[model samples]
Target: MENSIQSIPQNWYLILSSFMFCIGIMGVLFRRNAIIILMCIELMLNAVNLLLVSFSSYAGNAEGQVFVFFIMVVAAAEVAVGLALLVSIYRNIASTDINILSKMKW
Candidate 1:
């Protein structure tokens, strides 16, 4: 069983993960709303997480899973902080437009 599992090439996983990452990149590039952009960032993180998990599984190690857990924690914290910042911006600007956020430049 272990030999069979190990025989599966890593490139296949890499290709799929790369595809997901590209899609996430496109979403971030095309989205105009702050919320949507945040979601795209999350998507990208998830894609990378998938790749990490796959690699960890291939290596027969638990470290990848542990790293994934930490990534989830950081991603959650980012979402919380990002949404709060968005709310603060919306309170003052009344819009979530990414373009309009440029005015906040200090």
Candidate 2:
């Protein structure tokens, strides 16, 4: 039983993370909504975080986990700033579409 718990193969983790990252990339590429794009970016970040955690656990080390924590912090800050900008943009343009942003100029 003890060995079974630690026997999870790394390939599973790799496959899962890669799939998630690909989905995120697809979302970013195909979506026109700013909020959805932001969510997709978050998904990509989380996919990388998952990969880091899997590697850390497999290697018996904490460094990857520490890096994940930093990434989380940065992601939080990014969301805050991104949402604030989105709110302001929405107030001005009355829409969340990314194409409208190209017409904006100071």
Candidate 3:
């Protein structure tokens, strides 16, 4: 069983991560909703985390996993701040559309 698991090619993981990253990029580029864009950004981050973990496992190293841990922490902080901003924007504008944010003035 272990052998079978180990027999999987690293390239497959790379390909999968690449596809996910591309999807995330598309979502961010095409979506007009602030929440959707944030979700896409999280998707992209997760894709990177997946790639890091796969490479770390393949290389028999712990560094990548440790980096992933820090990335997760940063991502969490980013989400908290981002969500707070979104809430404030929604409260002020009564909408979550990114396009409307351009008209925001001090």
- lDDT string for model 3 (8-57, tens) is 99999999999999999999999999999999999999999999999998
Q: What do the candidate models score in CA lDDT, each in turn? A: 0.92, 0.95, 0.95
Top model number, TM-score: 3
lDDT (Cα, tens digit) per residue for candidate 2, span 1-101: 76753778998999999999999999999999999999999999999999999999888899999999999999999999999999999999999999888
Better of 1 and 2 by TM-score: 2
Query: Which residue pairs in model 2 clash with each other?
Result: none
The parts of candidate 2 lying over 4 Å away from their true place are: 1-5, 104-106
Q: How many residue pairs clash in each candidate?
A: 0, 0, 0
Considering only N, C-alpha and C atoms within 3 Å, which residue pairs clash in candidate 3? none
Worst 10-residue lDDT window, candidate 2: 1-10
- Compose the digit string of candidate 1's lDDT tens values, residues 1-106: 7476577799988998889899989998998999998998999899899899998988889999999999999999999999999999999999999888785688
Q: Runs in model 1 with CA error above 4 Å?
A: 1-8, 104-106
Give all TM-scores, in the order shown.
0.88, 0.91, 0.92
